[model samples]
Every structure is written in C-alpha cells, then in structure tokens.
Target chain A: MIVIELSERQLKIIEIVKENEPITSEQIAQFLKVTRATLRPDLAILTMSGMLDARPKVGYLYSGNNTVSIISEHVKRTKVSEIKSMPVVVDEQTTLYDALVSLFLEDVGSIYVLSHGYLAGVISRKDFLKNIMGGTDIHKMPVGLIMTRMPNIVTTYPHETALEAAIKIIEHEVDSLPVVEKFEEKGKEYFKVVGKVSKTNITRLFVELGRQK
Target chain B: MIVIELSERQLKIIEIVKENEPITSEQIAQFLKVTRATLRPDLAILTMSGMLDARPKVGYLYSGNNTVSIISEHVKRTKVSEIKSMPVVVDEQTTLYDALVSLFLEDVGSIYVLSHGYLAGVISRKDFLKNIMGGTDIHKMPVGLIMTRMPNIVTTYPHETALEAAIKIIEHEVDSLPVVEKFEEKGKEYFKVVGKVSKTNITRLFVELGRQK
Candidate 1:
C-alpha cells in the first residue's frame, strides 16, 4: 500500500511545514503564493489522510510513518558529526572564470562562500552564467559580489531522508543542496563542508534503491 | 587539467595510437569482450581533430571529430517519439480480492497482460512482491485467469519518453514495461509493441543539458 498519500498540492503543503512547522494556515496561503480557498481542500485531504497532526495552537506538521519519523529524528540528532573537506567556499569575491573551472572540474553545481569558516554566501552555475553572459569582467570580479547569501537558502543534516533531500530539490527548484555539519554550542565544525545531493543524483539513487526490491 | 582519462586496463596499451579517437578495435577482438587491447587503434592518430576521414587500410577509423557525427546521426535520430497511453487492461477472471483490495485500495503496483484484445497476465504489488518474496502461488497462476482486465492497465502514447513516465513515481520500480502506441512500417498509428527499456532507465541519462559559461 502507498504509505505517504498526499497529492502534489498536498505535498506542497507538507513541504511548507518542513520549512517551519507550527505555522498558521494563513501563513501557508501566503507562503505558497496560493489562496486559502484553494489551500483548504488540499489541507483537508492531508488531514484526512492523517499525514498531518493538527492542534489548537500548532498549525501543521508532518506525521509520517513511524519508521520514517523515527529514522528522520535519529538522523537529525546526528547532523554532520565532522566535515571532511576544508570548505573552500566560492563567494562574490571568487572570479567567474575560476568558479566555472572549479565547478566543472569538481562536478559540483554550487560552492559555498565562507567568511572565517562560516557560510557567508553561495554561488551557483546559473548565477555565474547570468552575470558572465551580461559581458561582465568575470575574470576580475570576485564571486562573493554575485553570490546568494544566507537565509534565502535551505539546508538539512546528514541524517535527513534522501526523500527530504529529493523534496527540497523539487520544492526549491535548485539543482543541489549543500550538506552541512551543524554544530551544537560553540561551533565545533563551523560547517566546514560535507557533501551535496543534486537532483540528478537524487533521481538515480532512488531508482537504484527501488531495483533492490 | 584532468590527466588520467583511461581506466586501469586502458593504461597498459602497447602502442600509443590515438589520444581519444573512436577506433573499431572490435574487428580484432570486438566480440571477445575480454580486454580493450584486443582491438587495434585507428592508424594511431591520423590527421584527426576535425581533419581526418575514414577509409579502408587505415587502421580502424578516422581520428576526426566523430562527436558531431554522433550527435547529428545517432543521438538525435534515436529518440522516443509520439507517446500514447494503453487502456488499463486486466483479465475478468482475476479474484476481486487482488483488484479492489490490492491494486485499487492498497495501490499495489500496476500491471498488464494483453494478447490481441484478450488481455492476459497481470501486474500488481502482489505479483512482484510475491515473486520477490518467493511466493510460488503467482508463478502457477495465469494473469488472464486472475487479471483486472481491459480498461484497467495504464498505457501511453508514442511522443512520450518512457523514461519520463517511469520516473513519475520517483520511487516505485516497474518490472513489466508499458505498451506505447507508435508508428510501425507504414506510419501506422497502431502500436507494434516496440522494444522495452528498464527500471534502470539507465541510458545513463543524467547530465543537465544547457549552455555553459
């Protein structure tokens, strides 16, 4: 039987919850750029399916299968224990020509810009292309000047479901996400760097997993 | 900057013929499928790199820009064209227990077994699961004797990419290939039940196509 029974629209709602639960329906309507009337039925289906646990104060939260929930929680607790690579972040300060070559050679869509080993900004191929295509002096311009900064981005722990990873790709319409090593109190890792989950990799990984069945 | 392009066995060649030319070494040992050294190199690297042309007595192939030839002749021409859906067909003889409870209610995997209008065989969660779990009951049973019958299975048109449809679940793996309606010899609308691709969808189709900066 299909376990997670949610339509595309309903799933969108669940995803919004992922971004931040205990969020109100009004905020959901505003966040998705959809109307409450349209959101109502979608919410109804999710609620009916018992995929969301509702409450008087807390808005909507995902109520996945016990197995999935337990797995997600355990993984969340671990986050990234240690970063393998010393984050060589690419920011607006990074040159366009350098960024292009780095991304291609590394086979990564993005490079994080770290200031003192902290995520300062992020630059992607799409961003680099747009600017370079505009006849800008890519070789001279630092990437930091053209990178996407914090808050506008989304990140997940190493323990999160690759399912969650897949959803992030679809929901945000991005090619890859930076896998970070979140620290507890005094920032042991400073989120140096770990790995990335690209949309293409996500699709291929799931297909391989399915085949084991 | 990438230095080692060839794999381990590829490094032990006796002679350095071509840098990256497509040679028909298969003539020497193509069918053997033992080692890369079996096939000979095309006249080493002739006036290639956009210059050479194929000719007899010239090793195997011209070391020219075969990339363009590959794109224009092979890659572009071999495409999945004109997709149409097959009617959900299953046998009426199938136990309602499978259809209503398994395929419909429980949303078991979809299956189809057709033979000249008289649909036979079946595809479903139980069919595949039982097969995987070592349930012998399915092997002895006939889908026609237990299928959901016509207007039950799902098929597609000719223009659609089978890979596209296969990736819809983004999770579920399919065993029985879907039947697509495409042209036959006489540009006929009737489907000839063309060749099948697999759950791997592994044409190794992963790279995103777009202009690079």
Candidate 2:
C-alpha cells in the first residue's frame, strides 16, 4: 500500500462531489473551468482511493471514507505473535522473594506463575510492593498466595492482533498480558503461557513505526 | 494526507521503473501494452507519492521511498503536548510511605519528586519495591533518600514530538518521562514538572490510531 498527499485540485473535487452528488465529470469540469481531460487524473485518484464512488452513468458520490482508515488498517494487520517478547515465568510454589529476584533479573514488569505446567496466576511489581508494605512475609509465602489468579487475568493469543492486545491493556488497566495457548485435559480447559505482550512492546513498535527510513 | 492501496498496475509500473531507470511514460505504456493516456493517472500517483522522481528530460527514476515513511510522518506530526497526562508529584521531603500512597491513589507507575517547586527526582514502583526489600524505613525515610535524582531523569518538553519522547523512553528503559520546562536561576538550571508521558500514553495513542473508523 502507498500513501499519497491529496493535491489541492483533488481535494476540491472531493468537496464539489460532497456538495453535489451524482454530478458528472463534464459538470465538475465546467465548474472548475477545466476540460474533462484535465480533471481525469484527479477524478481517477479520488475514486481509486475510495474517497469518491463513481456510478454507472451517474457521476460521483462522496464515499465518506476518511484518511484515518488507512492508518488503522496498517496497525491492525500487525499480529501479536510478531512482536510479543519472552515472558518471565515462575512455578507457583516459588517463594515471593525468589519471584521478586527473577523479576529484577529479567527486568520485566510482571511475571506469570504456573501450576502443573499450566498458567495459574500473574504477579506484578505493584502487587509485590503492596504486599511488602502490608507486611506479608515475602521469604515464606508462595507467589501464588498473592498473585492475581487465572480466569481474572487478561490474556491474548498468538493469532491476536497487536491492536487488540493494546486495547486490552488500556481498557483493563493492566501493565502486560500473558500470551497463552489453550489446552484440554480431562474435559477441562487451561492456558499455557507462551509469551508476553506489554506496553513496552507496543511502545517499541510505535517507535519503529515512527522511525524515518 | 490520504493513503491508497497502489493498484496492481501501479506496482508493476514501480517494478518496471526500478529495473529500468529514466524510462519515459511512452516506454512504460508500450511495455504494458497500454496507451500513454491509460498510464497518466498511474504516473501522476507515482510522482505525487514521491515513490518515483521525474526529471524534466530524464523520464522516471525510482525514488526508494517506502510505505513506512508515510506512517512515520503521521506519527511524528503528533506533539507531546497533545497527549501528555497529569503527572503525579510529591515533595522531596515527603516520607516514602506517603509518596507510595500518592502513587497508589493516582495509579501511575512513576512519581516526580519536587524540591521548592522544581523537579528534584523520580521514583518508580521498582524503586519502592527494592527499597522495601532492602529493609528501608519507609515511614521514616524521605523520598529524596531513595529516589533517582535530578540530572539523571529522562524528560520531554511540550514542543517535542511524541515519537521523540517514545524513543527516549525505550532507550532509557524507563516507564515514564516528566514533561518539564527548563528554567535558569542564579546560573543554575532546574526543571519544573508540568505533565508526564508514559508507555501507557504511547500505547493509548497506538490504539487510537489503529481503531477502525
């Protein structure tokens, strides 16, 4: 896909079409005091970009498609699997202190907890801070005791779009999401944490998108 | 600015131009077995988008401009002032516990510490967790004693682009940046924290840009 800045004449054509629907090329050219040949390329660009629609014999109609849709299309096509980073995971039985050590070592905002090889809970710096301030014994308590358990955690799959994952982060007020794969055992469903998507990843992608060629 | 998906013929035209630089419209038309009139709009679009350079006497030269530059232009045009949110601030002398309370109440990842109305330091959730784990006396110690001091903070100005700010955040590996105004007094420079830009803000903007119209 290519992006083009609409020329003044092209923009004016859109305005004219919006004001007068079903107007033919001859009428538009006459209004602009130019021949149909002169207006041909402008009309072609407007129609090709979906800004205007041309009918059988009925000239042009403004399609109401705006410039923002193009950007939206570009962003939504990026899948989460393409940008997701490795997650910091710890077994549910690990002590809170050990988990905190791993968090610092990995320099991640959050860590996923697993039980029997399935995602059981997620913990974050904020959770650990609150617990420590509340006098919870980090050395003795298992990470699972204070974690936000599964079924309450927001998650994204490898196939999900980055846009969808970013929306979840904003709406749910979470720092990161666990990218998981679902499995069935004894007619029960469980998610296995595979990777992670965080605001850091999204911000990094934004930087990359904004980088000049 | 408007974005349009280049038609198959346009893509072919670009490929042809790349393989054979300085090719005229007539030659391109002959190669495609179409009249020059039929290729007018395609040539207009290619030149207009800067993907091809047309010299007065020299035909068409592939410009090497890619699709990514358009997105970069759109993202870079957005300034930091347009999206910065209210910053959470605390006085340097405030006890660490009180500042943590403010951090929780505002639900922000970082807090700016002020000294006599000037930015003096910054503290994040990780900082607090580390201090707590190290057995710092949160109730007795002041925020200044444990915060990342001034001259070390990564900051942004209102006039700077969001893309520039996001780059700083990624490079510094920080969660947020204090939006500040620099002032000089008695030959010493200081910053007055005005607002904040965070990964959350960048992610939110990304979502907005990606949202379907």
- The Cα local distance difference test for each model comes to 0.46, 0.90
Q: What is the fnat of candidate 1?
A: 0.01
Per-residue lDDT of candidate 1, residues B1-213 (tens digit) = 000112233232212224423444544244345544322221121222222444555444333332211111111222344222233444444443334333443222354555653334456543433332233353245556545444443443345453444454243433334555544456633343443333223222212110100
Interface RMSD of each: 27.8, 2.4
Off by over 4 Å in 1: A1-92, A184-190, B1-213
True-vs-predicted CA distance for residue B80, candidate 2, Å: 1.5
How far does residue B70 in candidate 2 sit from its true spot (Å)? 3.9
**Candidate 2 chain B minimal-lDDT segment of 10 residues:** B66-75
**Residue range A1-213, candidate 1, lDDT tens digits:** 012223576667788877788788889999888877657656654554456767768788777621221111122222222222233456456676777667656655577777666666777655654464344676698877878877576665677665555556656756567777765556544554466665545445433322321
- Measured against the true two-chain complex, the DockQ scores of the candidates, in the order shown, are 0.01, 0.57
State, as a TM-score between 0 and 1, how close model 2 is to the true structure.
0.85
For candidate 2, the per-residue lDDT at A72 reads: 33
Top-lDDT structure, candidate number: 2
